[model samples]
Target: MSAKDRIAVFPSRMAQTIMKARLKGAQKGHSLLKKKSDALQMRFRMILKKIVDTKSLMGDVMKEASFSLAEAKFTSGDFNAIVLQNVTKAQIKVKCKKDNVAGVTLPVFESYQDGSDVHELAGLARGGQQLAKLKKSYARAIQLLVDLASLQTSFITLDEVIKITNRRVNALEHVVIPKIENTLMYIISELDEMEREEFFRLKKIQEKKKKIKAAEEQLKQTRRAMGIDVDNDGPNLFAEQHDEDLLF
Candidate 1:
């Protein structure tokens, strides 16, 4: 918005004081937002780095898990039967929590070992050794997935918060601050114009008083030349001149 459009027009000392206070507040807000943006940006970079590392690690874990599953299927004539036997209960459970990073709360997922002996039953069958190895590999994959989920969630949350903070900072720096400063200049200029007008008005009044005083002094001089008393509290020259003209 333009400065004039953004500012309120109030040309008075009270308005000036209020505007100054508002300007101070805007400046303080801008400073705080700048600091907040800086902090969030720092955290965003850290989270981004972690996400990259986690993704790379996830790829490796997924590949290992796939290879282990294939080996288990080759060694155990019926790997599907083993999976069915072990499908009774989950061995890992996910718990969710919140973590605060630079004023932004992010979700964190953790995996905990659940109470289930399904893996032990899977080992009771043929090729139980390969089945066990496959189970361990899958367990490692689950743990990595949980960690990756947490990192991904935190990364997205931080990115959004950083975007919002940046918008606020830019608005204050580009729009709000300049508008307040423009309004302040307008108020000062208006007050100065009022002062100048008042000075000119007073000057005119003083000049009119001086002209009146000069006219009264000239009237006194004329009456004195006609021998009329200057301070007499009576009808003066104009009346006396009228009387003499009537007699003639």
Candidate 2:
């Protein structure tokens, strides 16, 4: 592979060790993100189911509320203004909470009611039972609406979360992990090449040492064959001179 394709690091055993560790970490991260994506996708499907069911129920609840309102107005003669006048504060409220699923935080909307009565439902009930029925029907409709909204919101949020998580998983699986592994291979190859070169160099040095030792041994053998001391003898100036008295 081209040098640019692999990561640039000093080619050494230490660098190889680090790259192996990085590869392991990448693999681990990929596995975890894959699990997270699967979990988020499961939750996404559940929310989608809830949204469909809630929407279907919404139509019925709203229709019932409309019929109840009509019945209440016919029985009590349009008492909306009277009920509004008595209202001081809202009784039913929506409280928001967070739910964690597969490391993702999801928003949960809950409907709640205060301890006090809702407006003048009791006094209005005295006019006719239809007003109380209307109250219950509309409350049911409102709760359904809140539930639908919560489901839709969670659905959208989870979709985005799942997309992001899947992207990360794909990156690690296809890109990051491969790059690290390739770099590790490169480091290992470089280290192997270095070792081979070192071995060759050591072999050459030993060969040269052996040649030098053999040359010295041959020189000493030649000196002993000529009856010259190899180490202790020095040059004798008159050793080759013919003696005059011996010649007469």
Candidate 3:
């Protein structure tokens, strides 16, 4: 009755057939899930590498952006107020799409420019060169941030999916399939025992029939030797009349 010992199944040929089918299905499922786990692990490693590289670049990108902002500030007065006044709509946008990897759906983020750059002309009036440099540095930083976010999200998702897949694989491999096989072995052994019992019964019946036939043949031979009728139509096998036992 233990879960690992055997599955709850009837001990019959039909039950054995069913268990075989179930074992096949479990094995196939385990194989597919194992492959899926491998795929997810691979993706997780790639994402981890990307995150590490992106993080390493993050500090430098942020430093460059800060230096550009400082240079622009020193060259001219506060330009943030001017930019805030001119800012109306977003020129940069992110769109999401589903990416499938070994049956798992992952959301992929992509950044794109939706509209023309707003600051193309702002630098023409004052600190033109420094403002342009600052804009470039910040744009680079934003792109890096977007990439990092995408990598981190994928990493977490893959990690969770891999764990689930491995659990399923283990269950099918170690528990479900083994239990089904044990049930099959039980069914086969029971069937073989039944067949053996039937054979023994039939053998006993045949032996009894042979003994009956031999006794009838010996009786016929004894009647003929005693000079008694032995023909099938002459008399019964058991003679009842005798001169010595007759009394009138």
Q: How do all models score by TM-score?
A: 0.83, 0.83, 0.86
RMSD of each: 8.6, 10.4, 8.7
**CA-lDDT, candidates in order:** 0.83, 0.85, 0.85
Compose the digit string of candidate 3's lDDT tens values, residues 1-248: 45459976667877888888898999899888888888888888888988999999999999999999999999877888889988898878888888899988888888888879877887776789998999889989989988888888888888888888988989998888888888888788879999999999999989987887788789889989998887855665553345577678
Candidate 2 residue-wise lDDT, 9-69, digit = tens: 9989889889988988999899889989989998899899989888888898899999998
Clashing residue pairs in candidate 1, if any?
A: none
Off by over 4 Å in 1: 1-6, 74-77, 124-132, 234-248
The C-alpha stretches of model 3 lying farther than 4 A from their native spots are: 1-4, 225-227, 233-248
Question: Which stretches of model 2 miss by more than 4 angstroms?
Answer: 118-127, 231-248
Clashing pairs in 2: none
Alpha-carbon shift of residue 177 in model 1 (angstroms): 1.7
Question: lDDT of model 1 at residue 191?
Answer: 100
Clashes of each: 0, 0, 0
Q: Candidate 2 overall Cα lDDT vs. reference? A: 0.85
Clashing pairs in 3: none
Score candidate 1 by TM-score against the native.
0.83
**Which 10 residues in a row give candidate 2 its minimum summed lDDT?**
118-127
